[model samples]
Target: MSERKKQHFINSVMSYITLSLATIIGITLISIFISFWVTELADKDAQAINLSGSMRMQTYYIGLVLERENVEAAQQAIEKLQNTWNSPLFAQQHALLQEPKQQHNLLTRHFGIAYTNWLHHTKPILMAMAKGQHKRSEIEFLLENQVLLTDALVTQFQNDAERKIVNLRTFQLLVLLITVSVGSLVFYLLKNRIERPLSQLTETAEKIGAGDFSQRVDVGGTDELTLLANTFNRMSESIANSYSKLEERVDERTRALKQHNIVLDFLFQTARNILESPNGQFDFQTTVENLSKVLGDHKLELCLFTERGEKPYLQLVSHNKAFAHCEQTNCSECRNQDSSMQALLLSRKTGFPITIGERHFGIIDLQLNNEQELPEWQHALVQSVANQFAIALSMSEQKDKENRFVMLSERTVIARELHDSLAQALSYLQIQVTRLQKSHDKQKYELQQPIIDELREGLSSAYRQLRELLTTFRLKMDEGGLQAALENTVAQLRERSNISIQLDYKLKNVPLAASEEIHLLQIVREAGQNAIHHSKGRNVLIELIQTSDNKVQLAVEDDGIGIPQTPEKFNHYGLAIMNERSRNLGGAIEVQPRSGGGTRISFTFMPSITRQPIA
Candidate 1:
């Protein structure tokens, strides 16, 4: 899921959780409050109604004093009290008061047994209380039952009320304890299972945002909160894991891209050189050879394919002696055709094309000895190289056209100079010779000989200058072959300077395009020049190493004056140019101070001798 969606879901879940918890708490509070209110009401109702039995007894006492037929009336009042006591109102009152005092002496003895029986036998008491109605013993009996029973019942009621108050207080205490326990439990549960974990999750998220993906949260329960915690922990873990992986991948990709850029830059510079040269011709064979030497054992097979209608064909081109040839194949999947050529043709989708505007020049294709699919990034690098090739080719073509015009202009100037100076001088000399012949004199002959000698000398100088120019041109063309170019450069360097030079070179046998070869030569020449001009020591070491990316590297190191100590001093034009050249070739130049007091200029290029797709 998208991060936004995931965040929204998490937020929604938290909102719901908050609402649910709020509802549960609200319900619990309301329930407790209702219970408290109901208890209070029941307590008040019990106190109010408990006076009924006492009031009825008082009335019966009055009836007895009047000596009327009040026994039945007292009995009726007693019956009314009993019925009232049997209902929920009296039951509520009794439950609140009776149970807790069951084991007590006053309540159990007087209230529970004696007082209740006297109330039931009130008819006899009232009758005895009537005037002239019974013997003294009976009257005494009546008064005993009436006074003692009423006194005991009243005392029982007071004691029961006090005990009920004590029980009610104890009940309130228990309720308070239960409420506290439940609240504490909820807080503890929330803390361990939800709160703490959520806090950790927030911390983890912050850490992740800060580019640290190493935080984790603990899971403590199987409730919804626990499930949420587990999910959050997993999400954090995933983020950390993915972030870590992403960093590593980015780092790896950056390095690879840098390397690829180096190769591309090299190719670009090489192509540019080939294009900008006075002559438009370039040597691909040498370039391929140098690339192979630099790349090592993963063989490079260079092919030139001309756009044959809508398709491309493999035209084998190589410089190394170990290289094989491809013939008459259209596709790699064509079993009946040359497998290598067929493979080359079939692998066009993997190959990057060189194009300029509406023009399609060609393609540079490389296949690694490995079977793994090229990573997308590497494929992109390949395409970038192809694009550079197209630009380079276009620039070279334009440069070639411009060079032609320049050449024509130079040729015209030279011809005019020869005509206006040398030709006229020769013509004048011829005329002078004719005059001397006619005169037939010794002085004239001597003058004619001097004139002829001067003319010959001038002509010879012109010829020599032209030959030198041709020689220079040949050298430039030969420089496209990496090995030839390196040899030629070393030879020239050795002849020009007193520095001793060593070259170690190895590469695949494939032929590279002319543009590729020329850049390699420039790289070699730059290294040699830097060594000669900057390094104050004698010996200079140059090595060409190839890597898996179908690229070649030229490293020059010398036991001489190292790179400047300060950053400003390090910004010398030569070093800057060298670095730029390396970058243009899609490579890097590291000018490190040698451990033993020299400068090492190492250039690393990608798509190295063995080209592989990025993974």
Candidate 2:
């Protein structure tokens, strides 16, 4: 197709408006020129008529003067009449009337006859009368003829002026009619070509802007508006096509996002179930059931290998059924030889290994139907779930190991305490018994009493130490932690004595490990016991506080007879035990006499939480 010529709408409208203005201006200018010409001619005609009337009056004046025999006045009137008749204003009017082809015209002829009578007959006759050589009848005849001709000329001048005015009026009316016709034509053209098309284009554009892309302008013309309409239609089509494609893409993205959200929700819920399980335990059966639901039609099973890694000892199925291969006897042969288990092995299935680095725990097996397959994303999801299960299992196993280790460690500590306190006391009693036996054989009854009393004291001491050990072993940190334990110990000791004991505990915000707290509590109890037994003071103060260096400081003070400078080690087993406990806490103990009267026991140690590990 031949390309459509480009036509700007602005230029076209300007051309029409400019043409209309030019036509109106031309008509107005012509009318102005004609009106000016007609007005000027009318003024000249009026002047001519005035001059003619003066000439007629002068003719009559000359007649009167002649009748009275006044030659001077008659001569003067004749001169004035000639002057009026020959004035340039009348001459011009006369010249205008003397058209060669219009010689028979009434106004022209009348003017000529009137002028001829004035120049030839009237003037000479009047001159004759002025010289007093004239007849009354003859002068009257000439004057009468002159008056009649002048009146005829005057009448023609009036008629000519009136005719011109009528013609001007008619011409002005025609010009007005032409102007109205042209203006109406221009207005019609502008409304049809420019205004209507533009309105259509504007309305169509608004519709398109309002999202109705199907709207199109059908302006029929070769102007710029028509071209705009075509271009607008094409643009709308393009936008519609693009919008459709965009909607399709949005739908596709929405579906994919929904799938991703489902996957993420499944993973989040599974992790939450694992974390919120009772006693930090992971529910594998619940996890497998959730996994089966997420996998749609796939059958899921979790098989765990034995401790020795020889074979699978436990299996959890998502269908909530007993292990199909198990006979409840935990026999390896039964599990390995079951036909159902063999069929599952040989069938179409996918496996995700439950593993962490080199340690393989088991396999998460998905039994797929015939000809079934998994997408890459689904495969990755299943693998991630298996990894989560492996992590839970690994954490559970690690926690068990730590508990066993802690148990063994506590047992070792108990054994050591037994050997140090109770065993030693018993050995001392055995020696005392041997001494008593020797005295009896030697017939030394007096020696027997001292030995017997010594044995009894030894046994009592042994019994006391044993009870203390038992109390230490039985000590467990309750909800109130070490502070509550300390309070209970002080309360028990208070019941046994009248000594007022005050516990000044100030380490409220300090973080302490369980082992550290246990040792600290034992040391405090042992020190309190020693204070009650040996200090014999009226008041005992036990203070526990944190120092500026972030170390814990424990002080036990009394106002009683102070410890001897050379105290026997065998008598101060409590001091030895306190020293041992402080050493275990990685701290130091000080035994010093109070400045007034009693002794003070001070123990300072770095809190386990604040202590850094050795390189």
Candidate 3:
């Protein structure tokens, strides 16, 4: 049987109970046999005592007749006594308990000896009396020891029988206790293994029936009841989830209805901020602040393109407490782009350009900080807000040109209209692919392991990046340059490993391009992973220092076993990725053994442009 069905249900429990009851009954029969045997043994001892007493009495009567010189009567009495025990008719009724009947009994032999001695003493007196030559004074000595030996034997046997009865009683008491203990233990096991879980299950069911889906039974053991409990818990979770989703839908619709009425405030707010400015021009501070309120909790970056030969003006606004010190600072590092990376390492990054009919003007970048993905509804709402911005921007830029405004309005109409025709047909192909992947070990039969692995890696990375998109809503990014990025990397590693991952910053807030920061971050992450996976490193120290040659040095040292003599011994994908990132940074990576028996991996990047910080 499968493991699930082998468990004992109610029927099996009853079967075990019945078996226990049968065992008790069998034990009871054995106990009864023992008691009966004890009783028979006591009776046998009593019978032996009685036989000895009777033989003594018969001997005394035989002696009295001999004393009266009545030899014939005496002879007849002795013969009757002998026939009662030793004759063929009485032999069937006579036996020792643990001996064979062919063996002469000591009691019978001693009794006959007493009889013969009496005859020796009495015959002399009887013959003398017949011949008128009797002497009576000497005859008393032989009678003195008469019946004494048989009386002592009877006392000894009676004492032995009493001791046997005591032992039997003790044995019976022990048997009774054993039987009671066994019964109690069996019932105890049945109650714990079956009754308690059943009771909990009953309670949980009642709670669920009362619409309390949060309640659950704590399932234990490897039995049918455990399986039942597991099923019950799953049912409860499903009900809870259904109710939760229903409530969430109700709340979402209510909020959408409320927000729908005030959604147009975003345009008025932006225009109001611009008009309120002293110079009557767009202001980043007011624009970003008002825009952030409508978009809720996400980092907002607004940039307006200036004329050629001038840098674009950038402004950032967010409600995150961690970014309080970074206000008004440049966040150019946040815009790093690595097109080759399948995963958006920065997560949910969406950018909308402020343009009117191909006339690019400004830009808006919205993102989250943590790993929580924004729901599809929220994404649509944010996109709707961005559309309003686009319209406002276009209207502001073309206040005098009605023809251009009409052209700008047609762009939105064209984009939304395409969704009805070609877009819907492409959706069908996506559905077919989804179906194909849902069969035969997720379509692994048609794909090799490496292909499957690559597919999985791409999908996993994309899903993670998408999910974490909204959580990046938190503005945890530092405007303090590479130093802040390294600190963030160290903090991430420390959270995952028990090993101490400390950062030693020797360089000031060195100015690195956005691309340089991303490359450095990837290299640091890859190096830390290599230390953990390859060398089983414990202590990892990250250091960033300016080299004597004016280049920046980033090193990760570990107190682990040194690397192999040949670096190419293993297919080190992480190492390869790290090297690629280093090359992209215009740097050289060094791998060498540490002096104290570990590995120190370092890389140096020279500044590509002749740029220096202001003194």
The lDDT for every candidate, in the order shown, is 0.59, 0.79, 0.62
Model 3, residue 139: displacement in angstroms?
A: 5.4
State the lDDT of candidate 3 residue by residue for 498-544, as single tens digits.
88788888866456666677677767776876676566767988888
Residue 586, model 1: lDDT of 80
- Write the residue-wise lDDT of candidate 2 on 52-71 in tens digits: 78887778888888888888
Q: Using Cα atoms with residue i matched to residue i, what is each candidate's TM-score against the true structure? A: 0.32, 0.66, 0.33
Error of 3 at 412 (Å): 73
The reply for model 3, stretches above 4 Å from the true place, is: 1-19, 87-146, 238-615
Candidate 1 lDDT by residue in tens digits, 1-615: 477566555645345556556756765676577667656754654453355455445545545643444556655654555554455544544554466665455544554454355455644454454433554345445545555665665566666666766666766676567667656666666666567767877887787788765666665544555566667778877887887899999999998788777667656756665666555455555555545443332344444334343233434333332232232343322322334544564474444445667676655455545745655655565566456556655666788787888589557644644454445546655765566565466555556666566656656745643543343335565434667677777898898689999988876554555555655666666567767766788999888876555567667889997877763354243455456557756877777887898888778765333454567
Q: Give the lDDT of residue 391 in candidate 1.
A: 63
Model 1: ten consecutive residues of lowest lDDT: 327-336
lDDT of 2: 0.79
Models sorted by TM-score, best on top: 2, 3, 1
Leading candidate by lDDT: 2
Which residue segments of model 2 deviate by more than 4 Å? Answer: 5-252, 278-281, 320-349, 434-444, 478-615
